[model samples]
Target: MARAPADSHLTPQATQPGGHVPVMLAEVLDALQPADGGIYLDATFGLGGYAKGILDSAACTVWGLDRDPQAIARGQAMTEAEDGRLHLAEGRFGALDRVLEERGVAPVDGIAFDLGVSSPQLDVAERGFSFRFDGPLDMRMGSDGPTAADVVNELAEGDLARIVRDYGEEKKARRVARAITQARGDKPIQRTGELAEIVRGAVGHARGKAKAHEIDPATRTFQAIRIYVNDELGELERGLAAAERALKPGGRLAVVSFHSLEDRAVKQFLRTRSGDVPRASRHSPDPDPADRLPEPTFRVLFRQAKKPRADEAETNPRARSARLRAAERTAAPAWANFEEGRA
Candidate 1:
C-alpha cells in the first residue's frame, strides 16, 4: 500500500471538543488514510482523540479499545453519536486481536496507538499518574493491578532501584530507591504528594543550580512508578505484535509515543520488521544463521520518526515530546508472538 502524503491535513475540529488534542494528529491521519468501508482500530483509545478524527475523515468503522473502564464508560455517548460507526471496547490493546476475534470482527484496515498515560489520567489527581497532583498513589491504568503505592511500599529497594533506572532512565535510581524505602518505613507512603515530596527531597539537592526550564526532580520517579504499575512497556511489546496480526495485508499501523523508550521500541520493531536490521556491533557476537527471523511483514513509512509541528508543540505542552512512527503491513504472515528478550 502506498503511504499517504506527509502533508495530509486535519482541521481543528478533528480534535475532541474539549481541547484534548491528540499528539501528532495530522501525521497519524496521513499514515492511516481512513477510507470509506475500511475498518480501523484505535488501540489506545484514550479520550477518543484519534478514533474521533478517523471517524470524521471517512465513512469507516472504528473499534476503540482502552484498558481503563472509566475511559470506556466516558466514550459511550460518543459511540452512540457515531451511529454504529464507532464501537467502544474495554480491554487492553495488547489483547486487541483476541478482543476483535471474540466479537467476530475481521482483520482491520488500519490500527493507531497513542501510547502512554492520557491527559484525563494525568489531570485527575485521584488517578495518580502525575507528580503535579497529590491524590491517592494509584497509577494502575486498568482497575485490577497493584497500585503505585503498593509498588513503592512493598518492593525490595534493589527492585525499586532497577525499575527506576531501567524504566525512568533516572541516573540516581539507587538514591531514589533508598529514600523511598526509608520514608515508607515511617508509615506507608500512601499518597501522591508524599511520594513526590520524598523523591524531590532525595534528588532536589543534586540539581544544585537548576536551569529555569528544568523539570521537577520527582518527574522521573513518578513516571517510573506509573510505568511499573501499568506494565506499559510489556503491553506495548505485545500490542505491536497484536497489531501486526490483526491488520490485513496492506493495512497501516501508526503509533504516537511521548518518550524515548516508547519511541525506541516502535523504531526497532519497525526497522526489524521492514528488514532494516542494524549492523552487529563489533563488541557483540553475531547471531546464528539457523535462528533467522521470519519474512518481512511491514514496510516502514518513514526513515525517521515524525515530530509534532512547532506551532502545535507551542499550543499543546504535552505534544512537545511526542514522536510518530508508522508502517504498512505486507502479505507475509505475522511473526511469532513478541518475547521480552527478542524486542
Candidate 2:
C-alpha cells in the first residue's frame, strides 16, 4: 500500500446492480493495488461496486459481506455471474474475522470498507434513511435491531440530546431532544416526516422565509438518530479491528468514510497501529525498555487521506464528503487496544 508511481488509473463508472457509482473508485483501486490471483474482501459490499471493480481488476477471488439482507440477496446474482470467483455473506462487518474463520478464509490479501448508509438504502422510501424522503422512522441497517422510531419514543431526553450532541455534533441538541420528547408524548413519532417537522419547529427557520430553509432542519437530528439506532460508529470501530486481524502481512486495507466521525476513527486507528506516538506532555516519564511496543502492524498508504477529485464530486454530489484512508499490513500481530488510541 506504499504510494506507487502516480498514474491516472481511473475507471469509468460501470453501473452496478443498485445504480451506485462507487465513490473514490480510482483512489481505492490505486491504494489497494489488487493483484492477480489475490483474495480480497469487500466488507461493505453495497451494490457490489468496489467488489465488482476488484474482481474485474484482476484474476482474483472476492468475499463480499453485508448485514442488510437485501444487499446480500442482490449480490447473489453477482456471485453466480462471477462463476465461483465471488462469495457473498450476510453479516456485520465487525464480525469479519469470525466470518472468515468459519468459512476457512483468513489472512486475505486485501479488504475494503465503504462506511455509511448505501445509496439504495437512502433512495428507497421504505428504508427511511434520508430526511428528504417521507417514510417510516426505521433506520436500522439490519432487520432485527431497534428502529429509529423506538429510540425517539423510548429514550430519555438527556440520552437523546447526548446522541445528537455527540454523534451528530449538533449544537442545539438539548432543544431538539426536548422537542422530540414533548411531541412523542402525545403519540409515537412513527414517520420520518413527523420527526422532521418537529425538529424544524424546535430549531426554527429564517424569519419571513417559508420555502427555503438553511439546510434541512432535521438533517443533524436524523443523522444522529440513524447512527445511534444502527450503532454505526461502534460497528465501524469493531470492523476496523476485525480487518486488522483478518488481513495477511502486506495485505492492503482501504476504508472510505463519509463524515468526520468515521474519518477520525480511521485516522486514529491507522496512526496508532502504525506505531505513531500521540503527542505527550513534556513531564511524561522516560519509556521503560521492557515496555517498548512491538513493531507496527500497519504502514499508512498516504500521509493524508484521499478525497474524490473535483470532476467526480461534481458528477455525484454524495462523493463530496467522502474520504479514503488506506494501509498495508505488517507481519506483527494486531494490537489488542487499538480503541484506546487517538480516535
Q: lDDT by residue for model 2 over 7-119, one digit each (tens)?
A: 42334444555556888877788888888889999999878888888887778999999999999998888888999999989999999999999999898999999998988
Clashes of each: 0, 0
Where does model 2 exceed 4 Å of error? 1-12, 206-214, 279-284, 288-291, 341-343
Model 1 over residues 262-283: C-alpha lDDT tens digits?
Answer: 9999998888888787667899
lDDT of 2: 0.85
What C-alpha lDDT, on a 0 to 100 scale, does residue 337 get in candidate 2?
Answer: 53
Q: How high is each candidate's TM-score?
A: 0.92, 0.92
Clashes of 2: 0
Model 2, C-alpha of 339: deviation from truth (Å): 3.7
| Global lDDT of each candidate | 0.86, 0.85
TM-score of model 1 (CA atoms): 0.92
RMSD of each: 3.4, 3.1
